[model samples]
Target: MKNIIIAIAFFFLSYTNAQDKKIYALEFYSWVGANDNISYEMASIIFDSNLDSNDYYCNNKEYNALIRVKYSEKGVEKIFDYNAYVNILYLDNQTEIQNKNGAFYTMIIDGYAPAKLIKGNGSYNPDNFVVSGIVTKNTPRILNAYHLDDAEFLQQNIKNASVKPEYINTTDEGRAKIKKFFSSTDEMYRLLMLYIANFD
Candidate 1:
């Protein structure tokens, strides 16, 4: 029994090491709409040459926080890896929130699979966790999308919570009022986009 246990542990460790080296997200320099914008979208798993099915970190689609990344020529070299890209998402998303205080705006929400599940040999559970309100900003401004830390709350109130946004720009105070009324979710940004796309 002891030898068997030791062998299993060794195998698990070796497998994890191998998985850590793999590039899991598919990045693209493609164009969307007519903005001449270059973007990168990541998936939990890159479908084997076929692009047929995704091997998600979590089976639940909502938990996956992968978003298309946009880069200008000036910022292209800066986005060389996941760390830089993710940091940009955080900073840009916050900036959008701060800047849009006095304008008519829309907000989108979305989620991301927890970091643990993104591991090389990690297991997934559907009900594990989620973040909503991934995207939010004034329409013309079109702030970046992102996953926040409290999406699980929205899952409970999803029926009423997933409503289309109204662009109201009274003032910074007004934007704060709007944000305060809605419970921010990790998936806010993506959900907002879905709400707009479906309703519009």
Candidate 2:
């Protein structure tokens, strides 16, 4: 009987710890056409569902919030959020500039769909291709802003469909155009920050 009582107590303790392991985005919403300038109320609209705990690879790659934990060991607070870790590393070491710059450029430069691969007959892979030269590249712009404000849900969207590496042209002129796009992205990031501040 004593052994049974101890087993029951251990089970309850284990269950409580599991519950406190922290699952985020149970209330995420999927906002469209808006940046992360969303209000807490607005954020709630996209924070409607729990993270898909079963998809560990997806969780690790893009939407890490569900798996990241904030814990304390030996009285020191430790955070597992990938973004937070990067930010701290950036601040603590100026020598890490190259790494930081690479992160920034990659984030901004690869936001758009690549030029579609048109077949000799001019047809393309409908599921994989964006219309060539139609020139509407708003998704990444909105996504970047969303990252700054409602990072949690934005991270979730990235996990769902946006984090995969994309391709652009490798020619010199194409490279120049890609550079231009990244510059525009930086400007958009600044402008969106200003816009949000003014509205707030």
Candidate 3:
């Protein structure tokens, strides 16, 4: 019958659409001692298509995507009553989800409110501080390990630190020198001390 044919076509269309979606779990954290401790789940974002491009945008300048906020109240995981679009950024060409344990992406929100999701009354706000985090496909969740305020300072120090040519490239020798320098540097040590001392 004609009705049966239309139903089959609709079913395939819906299935195809669903298959094109991707989910990312976002975690928030603050620095504790020498390590970045896991704070909580900030949100679960769904992308309608493959994130293959190095850059993507919602409008002309805004990188928009759908998000579901997940949080905890009194040791219980609570899904917040908000689902909306948020502006995300991949700062530069070097930024990619495949990078290990780096602040490859950022979510721009207004100010620092530990319990608030996004900006307004559970809506998206573009006037907030930029919070950076790592992304991975191994799980639909993202862990925000570094508070941008503290992390930015440390990152700046890393950029300005003096290093030999052997420590500046992607070669094995370069990687070894980088590891050794960080292990012996007072700047990194001082940053870690301050991070633990000033954690909220």
Better of 2 and 3 by TM-score: 3
lDDT of 2 by residue, 1-200 (tens): 99999988986775564444332321111222233222111111011124454632121222222112122334543322111111001122324654333222111111122223211122111111011111122121112222222234366643212221132223443333333222333322232223223321
TM-score of each: 0.19, 0.17, 0.28
Candidate 3 clashing pairs? 24-140, 25-140, 25-141, 25-142, 26-142, 27-142, 27-144, 109-128, 109-129, 110-128
* Weakest ten-residue segment in model 2 by summed lDDT: 126-135
Q: Relative to the true structure, how large is the alpha-carbon lDDT of every model?
A: 0.30, 0.25, 0.35
Q: Tens digits of per-residue lDDT for model 1 on 1-200? A: 99999988986775564344323322211222222233322222121222333532112222122332222343432111111122112223335546444332222223233323221232321211111232234223333333222335676532211112224343443334323322243223223323323322
Candidate order (TM-score): 3, 1, 2
Candidate 2 local lDDT, residue 92: 24
Error of 1 at 136 (Å): 25
lDDT measured at residue 130 in model 2 versus the true structure, 0 to 100? 12
1 or 2, which is superior by lDDT?
1
